[model samples]
Target chain A: MKKIAKMVCILVVSLVPTLGHGAFQAIGIIKSVEGEVYLISSSTEIQAVSNMKLISGDNIITGNDGSVGLIFKDDTVVSLGPNSQIEVQDFVFNPAEEKLSFAARLVRGTFSFITGQIAKLAPKKVKLTTPDATLGVRGTKFVVEVK
Target chain B: MNRSLRVLSFLILSSIVTVLTYSGCSKTTVVLLKDPEGKVGHLVVENEAGSVDITKENEATTIAGATSKPAAPKRYSEDKISSQFGEALNMLPTQPKHFILYFKSGSTELTDSSKAQIPDILKTIELRSSEDISVVGHTDTAGNSAYNMRLSQRRASVVRKLLIGEGVRADHIQSTSHGEANPLVKTADNVNEPKNRRVEVVVR
Candidate 1:
């Protein structure tokens, strides 16, 4: 029994550090909510995760059943409709110090996005990929729908 | 002398009459060809104010006062996907995988090391652009359920914000706060297990 307890303690101790390693910061907001869908992020760092601080490199997404919203650190707003999926592929800020590479994938459904400062500085740094095509934005308001 | 003078005058008169008749006949033929339907074609003249109409007969239609021809209709090209990328993307997981993003106790801030992992997540989504994504937020059993729910939402929102900033459309994400309802490690109340305090990302 003593040996079993000691082994169990060792296993728990080994796992603790790995568990605390990764977390996300909140950098945006949820602007509106519909029946089962929500429109989030209008501009800047209006929203962040409840317990986490949203930093420059975090990724935000919707929940199952197609619902949620996000506002980024740079007053950029994004709204997701039903049955949609997107990912934040990359991001970098501080143009004078470092450049950002922003990329996303639209798996399915519709999404509306507003441009931000980072997008304006280096438009080629940002890319939105769909199953059919990849959208290279140079500072513009656009809607992407993927089926 | 009188006969010679009369002959010369007659030749001159005939030659002049012949030339006049030939010129008149050529003019009529030219005019016939110019008037295809016997009604002049309407000339469309565009200016800054608007379009003006002028009727005239001509061999070719023309837009008067316009410097250039009308533009052709625009055509869109199809998306080109390489076969290799398509095959590789097909082998990826279809259902959303659960990834735990652990946070410090009582703090929602993501550390520098934690931020590094975001690129991998983004790359996975980019590689599998055909799949939908779902991110669920959860917390340890230390806090109140209501508070935890709100906290989980905050965590989800953080991910949502980061993804959008990275160019993900706002509509592609849905955030829900499980509020410690689904614990990964499942310890007693206020145990402070790092695994339980996390946000799970599942790509569908």
Candidate 2:
């Protein structure tokens, strides 16, 4: 009976589309791309294109003459200048369960960020990390340059 | 001999100044910028040594390393910011737009004024190269939550259909119902709020 119950539980879990949160879902969309921008995901790198869906753990790299812009599901706007790179470290914007967070790392380049609902809902949840220091955003727009 | 020594000392001092300037340029910099609406926000730069708070627009700070504190905040001129961040700024995407359309109490029918905004909404969508639209339905707190949920769903569907009829791609639109859970105006249970009974369409 216990084995049968375990099998039934597994079947029910598989039947549901979502597992209570937006896991493995596209968290943002690339709005614009100029020049030679590349997106690296799951160890595969491809040329970045406008309107491409972005998931967590993705890295965006721009060539010397490339630039890109993206908007998260929570309306957070981020843009990169030429020769810049950034990683989407963590993103969770499930307002229903009050799970709101945004984090990114700027490896080496110029980046502009505009906070969104996640920062408005929770001031301390948004963070941007650079090679030298970490930034705690308090609902604002800012730019960073890592030499 | 004394004159030659003085000239040698001067050369050493200028070289030291050049070295310091080069190191300063290598430090990472963070600059706060004004939003499109001209509002400024705050930022906190922290490291192992200490933290610096940036409150004013155009304020900036530099960090040398992970173990060093951020430099004191200093405001930058508009010209300097533009020169350094022009590429990033130009690449920024347009902010998402939102429109609220009110409904006739407890019904999916849109009010006269709300119905009139459909053309404007469609025009905005047409201007964008790629459109991702969302139509969410909401209701007042007058009825039971379960019934209100279904009503809100119907309201969203009605608006979605209208947009589709106006030549909007059906795939670009997504409809959802928040019921009485999310309200525009806070109200007691079983209270009627015309402002609360509405559908919000977001164009991105």
Candidate 3:
């Protein structure tokens, strides 16, 4: 009986490594709150169970009723009004020197952006392609509304 | 009278004179003198209220009871891009080139074998395209969250400089460190997982 108990403990210990490997990647943080997700940045409240895919330099905020805002590393800040779905398809950032690259897809929502160093360093590098028109920014601020 | 008292009286008299002068002038005369260059001598309509100032600029036109009209909106055609450039952009990779650099336990530095891939990756980007590139550094959960975040960004910047040195335009690439925000395997802290330390590339 003693031998059997020891063997069982060893088996459980071996399986522990495999069991602890499932966690969601954090892309952003929840900044503030409004009727919906109002403000988002590096400093915001994020629930561990939210399962939102967050990358470095991602700022995401969700409201009680399901509004969201997403800010990316490229200094591209997006505010979602309500019941919107936005995904940060890709993002890259270097904090020490302030370099960044980001790409996001707005499936259905209203969003706004403030261009970051990526747009300033290489204006052509940042591209926001929408259904109607593709927006290319050369260090400018603009808003977009999509249905 | 004392000097101060006299000065005060003079100021009061001047105020009275200025008020009388303004009141004596007709509204039209006041409008004319105020707009010597006639730059502001135009009719303004707000909501239902409308006012017309017949100054020197509009006086040249001999039409009686002429009202100002809102400027016409200029029509603009869409700016077209050359097909050659458009085609080139379309052929580029839509997704970023991802490289997962596994690190030792509690370490942010790249492993020996992983460092070897950096030069080749930089060369490929330099030779293939002239567009901008992006490099993002990531880390696994091995240490404090704040420290991991900074480490990740530093790693990404290292890769960005390497690419720039290999003839890729420095202005064409940007880098960001995404600390431990996006982990490949979301396990508990101090896991020292290899999949976590990675720098991803996207060429646009």
Against the reference, the lDDT scores of all candidates come to 0.48, 0.83, 0.45
**Per-model DockQ:** 0.02, 0.31, 0.02
Per residue, candidate 3 scores C-alpha lDDT tens digits across A1-147 of 754444433222211111111233333333223454422334565442221335543434334354443334333444554444455545544322333456665444444444544564445555554332234445333333444
Task: Encode model 3's per-residue lDDT on B1-204: one tens digit a residue.
Answer: 999999999999998886555434311110111122223222221111223223332121111111222122222221221121222122112222334455555554668887788776766665544244557677878788999888877787777776766667776665666677666555677777777677776543
Give interface RMSD, per candidate: 25.6, 7.8, 23.7
Stretches off by above 4 angstroms in model 3 are A1-147, B1-96
What lDDT is reached at residue B15 by model 3? Answer: 86
RMSD each, Å: 27.5, 11.2, 23.4
Clashing pairs in 2: none
Given candidate 3, what's the lDDT at residue A109? 41
| Candidate 2 runs further than 4 Å off | A1-22, B1-26
The native-contact fraction of candidate 2 is 0.66
Model 1 agreement with the true structure over A7-37: per-residue lDDT tens digits: 4332222112111122333333343333343
Cα lDDT tens digits for candidate 2, B30-81: 9998998899999999977789999999999999866668999999999999
> How high is the lDDT of residue B2 in model 3?
100
Candidate 1 TM-score, C-alpha based: 0.33
Error of 2 at A123 (Å): 1.2
Instruction: Write candidate 1's Cα lDDT for B1-204 as tens digits.
Output: 699999999999998887565433321000001121243322232323243333332211122112223122122122211121222122212222345577777667655666777887788777756223556677888878888888878987898788789877676665666677667665778778777777666442
